[model samples]
Target: MDLPAKTKNISVILQKPKYAGNIGAAARAAKNMGISNLVVAGSAKYDQEEIKKRSTHLAADVVEKIKYVDDIRAALDKFSYIVGTTARKGAARGPFFTPRTIAEKITAVSQNNKVALMFGPEDTGLTNDELRYCHAVVVIPSSRKFTSLNLSHAVMIMCYEILLASLPACAEIPPKLARSSELEDMYEQIKTVLTRIGFLNPQNPDYWMTHIRRLFNRTSLLARDVKIIRGICRQIQWYNNQKNT
Candidate 1:
């Protein structure tokens, strides 16, 4: 595979989420759009682990990468361009645009600046205070009667728009997940080394190992990484056994 490319950096920032499912779904949507960074700020639901499970149909490992933060400011500290998603009008900050337009803005800024797309919680769209930091706001232009959207759906719509806007002219096919045989060999090596160190506890070991396996599996570890980790574990075991003797 080619070395990781220096591509456009686009981040999704979720503020004060009340549920983990929504966060997970947001993560799925972000990853689907080729956006790898998901930042969660403010309060979050405890069941977020489940959210990642449900939202990430095939990209659960990607969902696992979502980061939690305490404030929106911290969430967007490093981005060169920031856009807020909201339905409010004539009040926030500068000029506003539709989701498509926002995506276009993202593409434009992306040529030179990393961009951050910010979304607020389900209960409320972006609070006026958060808008103070935005370069512009992208409003969905919903009915005046009820403009609210479920957090995940909101993320999905935004991601779709962004993906549509940023589709490459040549569109290089993205890389595929690592093959399973390679993953199995890596797992076996890990189990062997763990057993040697007494970490795997041969007696009734399956119970604990099963859980660890699930966690690592959820990460969709690449075969290359599994081999690297296995080698490290082998070296550690060799060094430790030598010390004991």
Candidate 2:
């Protein structure tokens, strides 16, 4: 009963979760889906009793092995692709997808790199600043009047979709996708080149990079693709420098 390698690489991150019981439930959800990695961000006192009570013994391993970090950003370093779950939507959160759609996307990305599904506190979903770290947003479609779901419920739905999406019978062979570190470096180079070429304004640079990130996230850019992009950016930067000199 070993989990798929791709699914095992997927981590379920709870950002500033409030309830210990919910954390335990979330762990159960992740374990049930064959995802073992669980991370909690921000120090929030939770009732361990509730956690033990809710998770019972079936998911004791997940509850025991949960990693704690001070911030959500701290957990992103190891993940190639990050998907943040949010109940609220706005212009800032660009390109939101239903759970099913995001699950498909996650499965594709996980095939080539480590992926994370981030969940915020029960009271408030991911903040704009926190969401900035994510490559995409997964929105669980619900009634407008009551869009928010319980923390564990959200975790369950996300994990369930991902489990279904990760089934070997339905999965495609993935290309060698770029790791997060490589993508981040490429993005930085692109940003530098864009600025050098006067494509991005320094004073009020906003969604320029954000839009680019979303586009690439959807494209499932491979390692080779990232290298090509970085090469082009390097040439642009060099050309800009030559012109200035």
Best-matching candidate per TM-score: 2
Write one digit per residue (lDDT tens) for candidate 2, span 79-108: 877889888889888678888887776787
Q: For model 2, name the residue pairs that clash.
A: none
lDDT of 1 by residue, 1-245 (tens): 11122234677888888777777777877666666778888754458568768675676766777787877767776665667888767532446778887776566555545567889877867876677556567888666798888877777787777777666432342223333344445556777778878888887665565556545644544446667877897898799789899
Error of 2 at 119 (Å): 1.1
* Candidate 1 backbone clash number: 0
Q: Candidate 1 has which clashing residue pairs, if any?
A: none
Error of 2 at 102 (Å): 2.9
Global Cα lDDT for candidate 1: 0.67
Model 1, 185: alpha-carbon shift in Å?
52
| Candidate 1 TM-score, C-alpha based | 0.62
Off by over 4 Å in 2: 1-5, 43-50
